[model samples]
Target: MISSDAYILGKIKEGDGNAFSLLMEKYYSVLFKYGLHITKDTDLIDDCVQDVFISLWQIRHKADSIQFIRQYLLTALKRRIIRVETQRKKTLDLHDYEFDLQFSIEDILAERQVAEDNASRLRHILDQLTSRQKEVIYLVYYLQLDHAQVAEIMHISRQSVYNLLSETIRKMKDFWENAR
Candidate 1:
């Protein structure tokens, strides 16, 4: 039987520790993997995730208000990790903190039987994309999150997510066409 996040959330709001445990079990690996795309420090990511969950547990009363558990956890982790990294650097300038999505779609392209040269060209194009463009593609295509969920996790407007994804697709198409 599939577990419903809403049901789990309801239990969490009622202060059920077991329900909170289930939520942690379900999301720990996913959030850890997502964290790797932002920063390569596994130790730091693990600590940051623990902190996020601890904070959530402390505010369990608001659990019932969460719309999407995955989206909520993802956004929380993203902010926590970024803030921790920023504070560690001791530079008040958050402008330099970029997610720098460390993911690639090359394996999927290979499965599609795209020509080796084409895949190489695509990688080149992907490398040229801005960090936000790359993140939008990863969030939408790899993670399979909808625009609203992606926007929430990314801390951007839903329309901005759509626009970034559109722009990335256009760039890929342009490269593919020119390479043909």
Candidate 2:
């Protein structure tokens, strides 16, 4: 019996629509889960995963075998998420939101508010990080991709991935401590 990869590959190369449909059904959940981690929006995750498949189908001939398909799809999804985030950032006025607030409340209420505020602050801090650092953090922490995967995607050595991740964590820790 032919493996799913081989079956889909052959059908795709032959331009079989049914095979593509089947492939989509087989991988949609996995892709969507990956997409959600990257994009952080269920609705946008759907669109991003759809775009990945569309690109895959359009460039089927140029693509490598189905064994590499998951990696390819993930790289594409990461790029798309970055593009979307950049566009979204451009339209928003950061000056419109006040990052600093003075408040007096009970310890419990203050802690909850501080936590919420910290989450918002973290996003801004992430934006300030270098692209390489941001990418490393997303791959390692967000998508749960390992060091080898990140090195492969970023075209860097495994040691470089480790270095970047270490620096990123240190910088984030410093930023939070200083901010507080």
Best by lDDT: 1
| Tens digits of lDDT, candidate 1, 1-180 | 434998998899999999999999999998998888888899999999999899999999999898888989988888877878888677644334456665466677767777888778888777788888877777788778899999888878999998988988888779667655
Model 2, 101-125: lDDT tens digits are: 1223336436645576665566566
Displacement of the residue 92 alpha carbon in candidate 2, Å: 16
Backbone clashes in model 2, listed as residue pairs = none
Please list the residue runs of candidate 1 whose C-alpha ends up more than 4 Å from where it truly belongs after superposition: 1-3, 88-96, 102-113, 174-180
TM-score of each: 0.84, 0.53
Error of 2 at 98 (Å): 21
lDDT for each candidate structure? 0.83, 0.67
The number of residue pairs in model 2 that clash at the backbone is 0
**Candidate 1's TM-score:** 0.84
